[model samples]
Target: MREALIVWGGWSGHEPEQCASIIAGMLEEEQFRVHLENSTSAFASPSLSTMSLIVPIYTMSKIEKDEIGNLSSAVRDGVGLAGYHGGMGDAFREAVEYQFMCGGQWVAHPGNIIDYRVNVTRPDDPIMHGIQDFAYHSEQYYMHVDPSNEVLATTTFSGEHAPWIEGVVMPVVWKRRHGTGRVFYSSLGHVAKEFDVPQMRTIFRRGMLWAARD
Candidate 1:
């Protein structure tokens, strides 16, 4: 069985524990040997490299240098990393290395919790296949993303919330590589309940599996 690690902590507003639990349940159902930890220290485990995948549900938290270094090494060595929303994107705000590995960072969410649409930009990608454009009544993330990311989905700002960004198209989902590891991320799942949306759930599951090359 493939081994997966899920570490949750940091901002409670993101409901880290609950988010970790939701993903853990999905991974378990997929036959992954899921290990859940509530502390970032878990990233320091010497055996972290053995993991087939790692999902972090930490937001805006500070991670130690050595701990993050181990994580970076593990991913570069082929351990897949996948995450969603601010939990992964906004995590380690002070750690540029972590942001680079994630391929993006959450900068703002205009019109906090409003109706928006997520367009499927790469429907042919396995992670997005069979999923159509969907509407979300949640925070629409405005992020600073790595240009190298293979964008799979996107959202165009309506300018109703933020005038300057009116026509800006931002990446909602993307996949990239950090050395030998596949990295996947989605600017969704602000709260645990967001996973209840079928499209959101499906995309996330497929994204995680894709990252692990499962």
Candidate 2:
């Protein structure tokens, strides 16, 4: 069976443990040998190098150089990395290398919590498949994303929240390649319950499987 690891920690407001549990259940349903941990040190495990997927549910927190190095190397060597929201996108604010692996960083959530629409830009992508543009009432993430990301979905910002970025199209979901590994991330799921949204949950489920290595 394919092995997966979920490391949860950092800001508690994001409900890292709760979010991890939700995803853990999903992975279990998919038959992945899922292992869960609540520390960044889990990134240093030798097992990580052989795992098929790594899901980091950690928010802004410090990661040791060796831990990040091991995780980065594992991904580069074909172990997939998948995550979402601030846990993965806004994680390790000071760790440039980690952000590079994720292909984006959560810079801001203008207007805090508000209603927004997530437009599917590339319905042809396997991750998107039958998903369509959907209405979402959550933090519309303004991220610093890598230009190389294959953007699959986007959202337009209304000037009401951040006037300067009005009408700006921001990437809400993207998949990219880090070496031989597949990297997936979505700006959705500000909290665990946000995954209750059918489309959001479906997109995330597909993203995780798509990123898993053989």
Candidate 3:
């Protein structure tokens, strides 16, 4: 059976526990032997190397140096990485290394829960196979993104926001390669309710599969 390790910690407002539970259930249904825990557990770092995939469900927080090193080494050895929202983006505020590995950080959510459209950058990718142009009743995440990623999807900012930001903006999902490992991230999933969306569920599952360094 495949192994999936989940580490969740940070802000409680983002509903980290609820989100982590959802992912655990999903992976279990896929027949993967899953290990889930918060950052406080010693096992969260020690046995990480055996995992084929690591999913962080935490938000803005600090990741210890040794734990970071362990996680980094595991990913470098080809463990896939995937997460959404602040858990993947705004996490480890003081740990820039973690931010760097994740590829980007959250900046703003100007159009909060406003109607926005996600544009697919790689519809041909298996992860995006059945997904098409769709609208999310959520925030249009404005991010300080990494230019190296192979952007698989984008969302537009069509709100009366700012003169500095205009035209179509990108949000939703992206993919990148770090060393020998694969990274998949999305700016959605701030709330537990969003996880119930059919399209979002498909995307997250595919991201886990894609980022698992297959």
Candidate 4:
């Protein structure tokens, strides 16, 4: 069975613990052996390279140099890395390498907890298959993303909240590679309950499986 390590902590507003539990259950249902940790120290595990996938639920947390280095190296060596929202995107603000592996960093959420629409940009991609453009009620993430990402979904700013970015199209979901490893990210799920959104949950599930080592 594939092994997955989920490290949860940093910001309680994101409900990292609850989100980790939800994801652990999802992976367990997929027959993966899921391990859960509440601290960033888990990233320093010497056995990290043995895991098939790693999920970070840490937001805006400081990571030691050696810890981030080990995590980055593991992903570069073919271990899958996948996560969503502030957990991965907003984590390790000072760690450029971590942001690079994630393909994007959460810069701002114009209208916090507001209504928006997500457009399916690459419906043909397996991770987005059968998913359609849908209405979302959460922070509309404005991010600085890697142009190399294979963007699968996007959102258009209405200018109602942040006028300057009006009509700007931002990536809502994307997948990329760091060395031989697959990296997937979605700018959704601000809180644990967001997972109840069918489209949100389904896309995340597929994204995780898609990033896992074969």
Q: Between prediction 2 and prediction 3, which has the larger TM-score?
A: 2
lDDT of 3 by residue, 1-214 (tens): 8899888878998889888889999889888888878874432366777788899988886767887877877787788899998888888778877877888888888856677777887889988887998888876788888888778888877657754677856656888887788999988777899988888888988899889844
Candidate 1 ranges with C-alpha deviation above 4 Å: none
Looking at candidate 4, the ten consecutive residues that score lowest on lDDT are 205-214
As a TM-score, model 3 comes out at 0.94
lDDT (Cα, 0-100) at 39 in candidate 1: 91
How many clashes in each structure? 0, 0, 2, 0
Q: Give the distance in Å from residue 118's predicted Cα in candidate 1 to where it truly belongs.
A: 0.2
TM-score of each: 0.99, 0.98, 0.94, 0.99
Ranking of candidates on lDDT, top first: 4, 1, 2, 3
Residue pairs of candidate 3 with colliding backbone atoms: 80-211, 155-171
lDDT of 1: 0.95
lDDT of 1 by residue, 1-214 (tens): 9999999999999999988888999999999999999899999999999999999999987999999999999999999999999889999999999999999999999899999999999999999989999899889999999999999999999999889999999999999999999999999898999999999999999999999999
Better of 1 and 2 by lDDT: 1
Q: Which runs in model 3 stand beyond 4 Å of their true positions? A: 40-44
